[model samples]
Each structure stands twice: as structure tokens, then as C-alpha cells.
Target chain A: MTVSSDTSMIHAVGLRKSFGSKSGETVEAVCGIDVDVRRGESFGFLGPNGAGKSSTMRMIAAVSPISGGSLRILGMDPATQGPQIRARIGVCPQEDTLDTELNVRDNLYIYGRYFGLPRAEVRSRTDELLEFVQLTEKAKAKVEDLSGGMKRRLTIARSLINKPDLLLLDEPTTGLDPQARHVVWDRLFRLKQQGVTLVLTTHYMDEAEQLCDRLVVMDKGVIAAEGSPLELIRAYSTREVVELRFGIGEHEEIAPKVEDLAERVEVLPDRLLLYSSDGEETLAKVHERGLDPIASLVRRSTLEDVFLRLTGRTLVD
Target chain B: MSSTADDGSGALPGTLIRATWVTDYWLTVYKRTWKGTVISSFVTPLLYIVAMGVLLGGFIKGDPAKLEGATSYLSFVAPGMVAAQAMTTVFGEVTYPVMGMIKWHRTYFGMIATPLGIPEVILAHLGFVLFRVATVCAVFLLVMTPFGVFESLGGVVIAFFAQLLIGMAFAVPIYAFTVGLKDESAFALVFRLGMIPMFLFSGAFFPVSNLDAPMEAFAKVTPLWHGVDLTRMLTVGNIDGPMVLVHVVYLSALVVLGWFWAVRRLTRRLTD
Candidate 1:
């Protein structure tokens, strides 16, 4: 709620991270990358596995030291003013590190005390967060008893205890069921409506599309592409995407003949994707080829289209 | 990012102190896990004393008793009990507990994230461990006293202080090892190789001279040997100034070395 000026919430330039292996080989987790997260915007890092999303998230959270870069959080250097910057930031890490020893309410209470909150204020806020997360009845229960979705929700509630100016969530709903995922997304959307700055990393293109105001797709520790989801879809893809599937090996024989029907054509292992501004026209042209595919579906261009256009595969790989 | 103006709160004098306060908050974790700490520090030592000193005391002769310069076996064994108790209590309190915080629980990471530096974490953790060791040692001393082990009031006090010193000495190396512990094997090695020999050969049950020549020499060089000697001297009122000097010097050296290593390791781990 306390918006301290409209300055950029987080900024980093030429950030890099590398870990030395036992064989004296150094694995570059994050190559030189620049990023800026302005106030009141949902930012996202969308990438496949081992694309350095976690390494970047760790550096931004001030939990891991940068190898070679200048980084700032709330306009303060994380290298020097990590404590000050962290004081106002909430980070929900990729892996849940919730204290299992304490009850759900105590978990919030103890974490709030870590931020030096008055004990009375912490108690009041814990009550509020439990209600917000719809966990009022389960506040006295141990963390180990909670389901995966419930634990994730508790973690999100714990992060909001200090009412942090900036919130960082790494894959916020990676392993949740669809209903649970929607519930998390709904809560995050509400936080965003209140103008909280959110930075999230995810492999789900659908998640990025749903949450991010702006996103950067990364590959092999480098940014492959960056833009708003809609902007990316428009810039990198057509207005519609047609997926054509044939009976097993039939795709190979018919795929090469359907290339001229769309603006761009991609022959995948299981299917063929035809990109065109008009889906009906492309499908009519495909019908004119005198070949029948097992199945075909035309959908509007999405962030997944952008991902496929840039990385030559889906984001979930 | 604002590249020029500085807030300047980073240099606050109370920052480290506040961080220690935050790190101290983790002691609440013990409210749920006090059983582990109790069993290792107090229960294990009590069992050792009861099984070795009480149960076996009737079977062994108490004359010149192989432990030279001792009037009775019980007197010698009693002082040795204090030293042994101190080493185990201190070692158990600091080693696995500190390592659990660092690697297993990752509680230090949570602490460091909240403006608490690694040194504050170290200091707070050590302070808590030492306080716990002192309390457990006191309780052990009192418990043994009812069994007629504490001959003089001064003996009880000497045994307490001796345990504190030896426990601290063992804690120093354990703290140093904790920073480098990549896995549980390292601590297993500490218990098996480092502490087991010190327990058996460092004049805990019998006098060091009773051991074969090389074994006695090895025991003489150990911190626990000096601790036992100092405690025994104080208990029997045959105090030697040089022996006290050796205990102080050895323990002081270990403390300095361990603290320096821990600080260096933590700074590197935090900053790097």
C-alpha cells in the first residue's frame, strides 16, 4: 500500500552466475542478462528447464550473490543493502521451505517476527492473511498435514505478512491441479489489482500469458525473446495456429504438401502447425490437397505460438 | 536504479546485534525438538556414568587401582566423569545442531535473508549452544553429586568449569567442520574418529599413564586429556599450575582457530 515514489522496483544489468564443477568445468547458469521491473507491473521469466530462471530469481531475491553484474532492488544495491532491500520484499522460492515444526498460524507469526513486526500486529495480520487465503479453519493445524495446494497458499499468505512492496514468486503454481491453479491465479490477480509489483518465473506459457504484463522467454541461460504476451504473439506469430495430426506415419507423407497453405509451417514429431492470418482459408487450402489428417484444430495465436516460433518447441519441454 | 544517493543505514551499529536477535528467534524451533538435544547432551552422559562408574565399580578393585596417585577408584573415576560429560555435552550441542541449522534446516539462510549476517548467526548459535551445554553440565553435576560423586563443593565447581572449557574446545573444531560439511558423512566421521578415541583414551575411565606409551602420549596431546587432568587436579586438591596453563592454552587455541575458520567460511559462503 505504501508506494514510495514511482521508481523501478527491481533493475539488473549484465547479470551472470556460474558454478564450478568437480572436473574443473564451469556451468554457466545465467549468462549476461539485463532486466528492469517498473512499479505496479507483473513481470515474468518464461523458459524451459535449465534456462537459468531460478538462478536469476535467486539473485533478484538477494539470496544468492551475483557473479558479475550490477543489480538493484528498490533502487538500492542488493550487494550492499541486501538487508534493507529484503526488508521490504517478499520472496516465495521455487521450492517450499515452510517450517514444518510450527502450526500454520505460528509459521506466519514466526516469519512476521523475523521482519521485526510488533507481536500484536503480527497476530492481527496473521488472522487477516488466514482469512485472505481461506485457511481460517486450518490455522491451528501443522504444515505437514496440508495438501500441496494448501501449502502453496499458506506460503503466499506468509509472504504478504509484511505487506511487501515487491513480491517474487518462482513457479507459483507449477504442480497444482487445474482448480487449485485457478484459485492461486485468482488470488494473484487480486494482489495485482491492488497495484502490488509481482515478479514470477514459470515454464507454463499459459501461466505466463495469464499473469505477465511483460515476459522474457529464456533458453540456455540467455533471453531468446521478450515482450508482452500479446505483443510477442503478434510479432512472432500469425493470427491463428492450426495443428494437424495424421494417423501415425501418415503425417510425414502429407506434411510437405501442406506448406504453401499458411504463412509458416512447422512439422513436429507428432503434428504439423500451420500459422496463418486466416485459419478458415488455410484449412480450406489443406482440404484442397486431397489428403485427410486424423485430426485438426485451429486456435487463436497465444504466447505458446510465440514460444514455438522462437524456440522451435513448446515451453513445457 | 538510483545510482548516486545512499540511504546509509547499512552502517548502523545495532545491525549485527539485531541480526543476532533474529537468529536467536530460531531457538523456538527447539520447542518442538528438545528431545534430540536432551538425549544427546544429558541422557547419553548419564547412561555412560551409570553403566561404567556405578555398575562396574563393584567388580573392580579400588586400591592403587592402576590409576597412579589416586587414593580410590571412585574419586578418580568421578572427576573423569565430569570431563567426559563436558566433552560430549558440548560436542553434541554445537556440532549436529549447528550443522542442522546450516545445511539441513537451512534456518541460517532464512536468518541471513533478514539482515542478519553469517557472523551474527554464528555468534547467536554458539551462544545458545554454550548456554545449553552449561545448563546440562550443571544438571549432570548435580545428579552425580546425589550419588556421592562430588566429594567437595569445590570439586563440583571445578568439574563444571572443566566441562565448559572442554565442551567449548570440542565445539570450536566442530563449528569449523560444520561450515565444510557437504554431507552427513563428515559428522559421522567426527563422532566415530574424533570423539570416540577422546572418550576412551583421554583418561576418562582410567589414568592416561595406564595406557601404553604411544597411546598415553596421544592422550596427553588431546584437549580432553588436559580437561580431565585439570578437573581431577581440582577435585583431589593436587592442583598443578602448568597443567591448568596447558588446558587454558589448548582450549584457547582451538577457540581462536575455530572462530576464525567459521567467520571466514561464513563470509565466503554469504558473499560469494
Candidate 2:
């Protein structure tokens, strides 16, 4: 199978993945979906857990076989040319698979050697990667001793050892703290600046907004929406959201009173989100209705609101 | 740092020599912990020879013909110890380390993400296991020299090769089993039921011929029995041409079969 060289970095048409359980039942993890990721673009799969983001990432990484449909990575068929495709792409799996037995520096060096990199080149690259991840001081420390953020950085550094043209990150900062997430985000932004085409899966709408040039919102094994973060928000949500929290079960009662205050009012369990062009105006109307709330805030709409609008559920829940 | 544009046509060098990098990774890891393993590889085997071969051989007053025609029991059991030690060493290498690489540390996942494929990963790990078996056998032979177990230097050299074959024969299948396992419970069962019986009944401590009809026949079918017999023949200079051929073929077949299953299983597990 020959693929055109000038094609997108990742191109898929109606791709699918189904897993067979021991009880002879089939679970369709990813039902047919189409996606295209161009060169130097940070593409994202944004969804909640079990939304087939990981399944799709695995197929693109050439580690998992696609059950159906056509897929090409680096202009090569992943099914027939897994090694060749893998040689040019970096995969940072969701979980940290760092070698705990080796120190931080050796982890990078050994992984580089696996790619048949020259010894001197691997040595120098290991040094540079340690610095790139801001782990130069911890280069000699064992991987098990590093914090979660450091391990994620080392994993990213290990992925870049071969200087891949396309990088795949599966939830790059899932379990990280806010500060750690920003650190990882900064490093990823730098990689994108270097023109590495990145394809990442993230449930964090903020991560998708901060890093992705284009993204698809997936739910229940299919794409519900796709566009740039701004496009997604503009299409599915209002410019701003007025968040009003009443007493525990008072949101349902309060939502009706504020119904005409915005274009739409979504009554969630703990809070009522009012979708409107002007959040402050919506909040003023909510107060004018004589309905009091425990707390109220006006903020610009984000991808989270887009996800909620499209799926009728929050990104995390 | 170099921003060389990838043309999407460059291929990885998927050569055998590149697989040695996995072995190199293990060797580098071993360098840090070799001191801890030295005692088990060398001293423990030495202690076994002294305790079982020397101290216990003192009590077994038997005719040379009955004790495999050897003049002393120490010489009789020394080669068996070499084969047993090889089995133990290779078993250790293939079990927890293999499982750890797959499930715990996920080192194999990390390797497959690179240009290294499943076959290369399996071969490289087996290569490292062979190195470990060689080291353990060398140390065991060196320790045995003080006890005058060597009939001839060439005989001892052949015994070393026999130990290597025995180790590989056992390492590959156990590696396959290890990769399939989700937990370490089966490993304990393997040690208790499989390894212990083979160590005791496979002519490692005494001639299997001394057992009853059914038991002796059972021992003959075991891979370690072939290993022990081959090493004993080489160490004792009682080289039997046809029997030697039989032992080598049996061990070689096991190694080949084990390799086939291991590679297939590991590829399935690592890829999908």
C-alpha cells in the first residue's frame, strides 16, 4: 500500500475499534470516525473518560490495530508499516511507562538507543532532553523518586529522543496539579513552536483550548463536534456564561425564574449556567428577579461550555 | 536542536545489532546491582556444592559403578550442580524481570514505541539472560576447580556450553509464561511445583536411573534431565556420541519451540 507523501500527518476515514471480552461479548470502543491532522498543527481529541480518545490514540500510534476503516500516519499504512510509522512518531501514553529501574538520564539514553541512534548522539540528546524537561538536576535520580510532573516530563523527553515529526500525547497532564499542568503545557507549546505536529487526547477543556489548533469533541465512541477551540465555543455556546449557585436543591426552582435572562439556561445539579452574549447583563437580570443565590460569577465561555452544550453533559462528568 | 525536515521516507535500521541495545540496557542496569547478585550467583552455588556435594557426599559410601562410576560423589554431583544453577539463574532472569518489563515497569511498552519490535525485545532479553547464565556457570566452574571436579579442561569447557543450552531452553518458555501472567501467583507455583521437582528429581542430586521405572522415565522427559546428563558426561569425560547428540537435539528443539511461542505471545500482548 502506497500513501501519498503530501497527505496530512494523520488521516483516518471511518476508523473503528472493538474489544472482545472473555464472555464472548464485543465492546465497541471507537465506532467509525473520520479525522485529519495536518503538519505542524496541534490536534486534540477532547472527551470524557471512555470516550474512545485513548482507543483512537492507540490506533494512530500503531500499537493497536484498527478494527475497520482506513488510516494513514506519516503517509504510511499503520497496519502494514507499523515499525516505519512508529520510527517517525513519538507516543506518550496516558500512563507513565518510564523505566523505574534506570535513572532519569539513562531512561532517555536507553530509549534513544532503542531507535538505533548513534551512541554519542544519544548521549548528547539525553543531556539536551533533560534540560528541555527542566530535569537537568534530577538526571541522575531514579525515575521512581521523581514527582508525577517530572515523570511526565521525562516521558515527553523520552518520546522526543528520536526527534519525531509527529508527536502523540495521551492526556499529557491528566493527574498533574495546576502548576505542573502549566509546566507541561509550556514545554508542549515549545515543541509545537518547533513545528512538531502534535496529536493529543485530553478530557481537560482548558488543555485542549490552551494547546490544540483544532480539536474534536468525542462522546460515546463518536465525534459530536470538531473545530478550533474558539470555533467550537462560538458554534455550540454563547460568548459568556453566568454561573449561579443556589442552595443544594434550589437550582431547579431558581432556573425557571432566570429562564428569560439569557439565550438558554442549563440547570445542573449544583448550579445553573446561563448562556448569554453578555454575562454581566444576565447576572443583573438574575438579581432583578429577586431570586437569591449562594454565589454568582460571570466568566467567558470556554470549551467546557461547548462540550456541555453539544453533549448535554460536562467534560469531566 | 537540529530542525531537519523529515521527508516521511526515512526508514529505521531494523537490524540484529540494534537489538543488542536492549541487552546493553540490561547490562547498564546490572552494573549498579551486580554486587547484590554476585553472592547469589557465585557464593550460594559454591555453598551448595560444599554442603550437598562435599558434606553430604561424605556419608554416601557407594560403589563407583552405582554412583555413575565416579570415584567420588563430589565429582558425580558437581556437574549436576552446574546445570541446576544454570536453570535457577535463567528462571530468575525470565520470570519477575520479564513480568516487570511488561506489566509493572512497562519497559517493553516503552521499547516497542521505538524502532525496536517485539522480536527484538524478546531476543535482546534472552541475550541478556544468556550472558547471566554464562557468568553464573563460569563462577560455578571456577569454584568447582578447587574441589578437583574437572576431569579435563576441555570437558569443563563443553559443560559450560551445555549449561548455556539448558538455560536458554528453560528461559524462553518461562518468559512466554511470565508475559501471559497478570500477577505473581503463578510464578510462585512454577517455582514450587515445576522448578523444585525438576531440581530434585532430574538427576541433579542423584542419578535418575536410581528411581523406579515410571519416575526414571518421567525424569528422562524433563529438559533439565537432558541438561544434567549432558553436563555430567562432559565434566566426567564419559562422552557418549549418540546420547550427546540426543541431549543437544532435545534442548535445541525446546529452545526453538519456546522461542516461537514466546515471540508470538509477546507480539500479541505488546501490540494489541
What interface RMSD do all candidates show, one decimal each?
A: 5.9, 4.5
Model 2: how far is B270 from its true place, Å? 2.6
What value does the lDDT take at residue B77 in candidate 1? 78
Residue clash pairs of candidate 1? none
Candidate 2 CAPRI grade: acceptable
Q: What is the lDDT of candidate 1?
A: 0.78
In TM-score terms, candidate 2 sits at 0.94
The C-alpha RMSD in Å for every predicted model, in order, reads 3.7, 2.8
User: What TM-score against the true fold does each predicted structure earn?
Assistant: 0.89, 0.94
The runs of at least 3 residues in candidate 2 whose Cα sits more than 4 Å from the true structure, single-residue gaps closed, are: A1-3, B1-15
Lowest summed lDDT window (length 10), candidate 1 chain A: A1-10
> What TM-scores does chain A show, candidate by candidate in order?
0.96, 0.97
| Strongest candidate by DockQ | 2
* Model 1 lDDT, residue A246, Cα: 86
The digit string of per-residue lDDT tens for model 2 on B7-27 reads 223244444655766765887
lDDT of 1 by residue, A1-317 (tens): 22343568887899999887779999999999989899889999998888999989878887678999788888777778776676678877666778776789988887777676667888999999999998999999998899899989998998888788789999999889999999999999999998889999998878998999998998889998888999898899999988899877666777679878888888787898999999988887888877677888989988877887888876666
